[model samples]
Target: MPRPGSHKYDIKRSRLRNELDDAGIPDKRADELANEILRNPRGLRARLTHVARRFVPRPGRRGT
Candidate 1:
């Protein structure tokens, strides 16, 4: 069974992923940002910025 707050995190992650997609954020950056949050309880702004980095497209070659 999922513990308390587990479902909430899932919802939040989904929302964040959707937002990142809408914003055209790269998959790697978006995943990194989401994983970082789940991995630790860090500052708000820093985490958000990290997620935002995904939006920036890279030149040449497809991102993994």
Candidate 2:
């Protein structure tokens, strides 16, 4: 039997896979990447920083 949060972990994994797919990553590669990220201690923070950088503009001159 799975532990109490096993189902939740599965759900989070599935969501990560879907997000990767939506970003144009192939299914197999997405699964691999998702698993790698989830297995890392700092994965969540790293992933969040990566995603946040996409939306948040960098402070710099108009054209450099």
Candidate 3:
């Protein structure tokens, strides 16, 4: 469990929350995600993607 009362932890958590929010996650969900990420032993070792977007060619167009 993380020490939510610590000032440093709070500051970091808030920063993570803001990043998540900018990533298009809802405020509530972002808070949850931040908590989970903070609990990781490696501390954000891997990139997280709630939804991955890819570039798709147009229906009738293809790379020449």
Candidate 4:
């Protein structure tokens, strides 16, 4: 049997993939992107910012 949080993680990952699909993203690509975001230290926030950046431009200058 999986650990306590493992099931929750699976549910969350599945939900993320489903949301991506609902947004019209291809299944394979969505899965890949979801996995990438989940691999990040701040997975949920990283996923949000990744999607948000497509519609919202950064406020700061382009280059430092």
Candidate with the greatest lDDT versus the true structure? 3
Clashing pairs in 2: none
Tens-digit lDDT track for model 2 on 4-62?
Answer: 24887677778988997787667997787677667674776887577546544578834
How many pairs of residues in model 3 come into backbone collision?
0
lDDT values of the candidates? Answer: 0.63, 0.69, 0.70, 0.69
Residue by residue across 1-64, what tens digits does model 3's lDDT show? 4577688888889998998888677889889878888777464655363222222244687733
Q: Which ten residues in a row have the lowest lDDT in candidate 4?
A: 1-10
For model 3, where is the 10-residue window of minimal lDDT?
Answer: 49-58
lDDT of 4 by residue, 1-64 (tens): 2232487667766887898878766899888776666666467786677776764457874622
- lDDT of candidate 4 vs native? 0.69
Candidate 3: C-alpha RMSD to true structure equals 6.6
Q: Estimate the TM-score of every prediction.
A: 0.49, 0.57, 0.62, 0.55
Ranking by lDDT: 3, 4, 2, 1
State in Å the error of residue 64, model 1: 21
Residue 52 CA displacement from its true place in model 3, Å: 4.8
In every candidate, how many clashes are there? 2, 0, 0, 0
**Every candidate's CA RMSD:** 6.5, 5.6, 6.6, 6.5
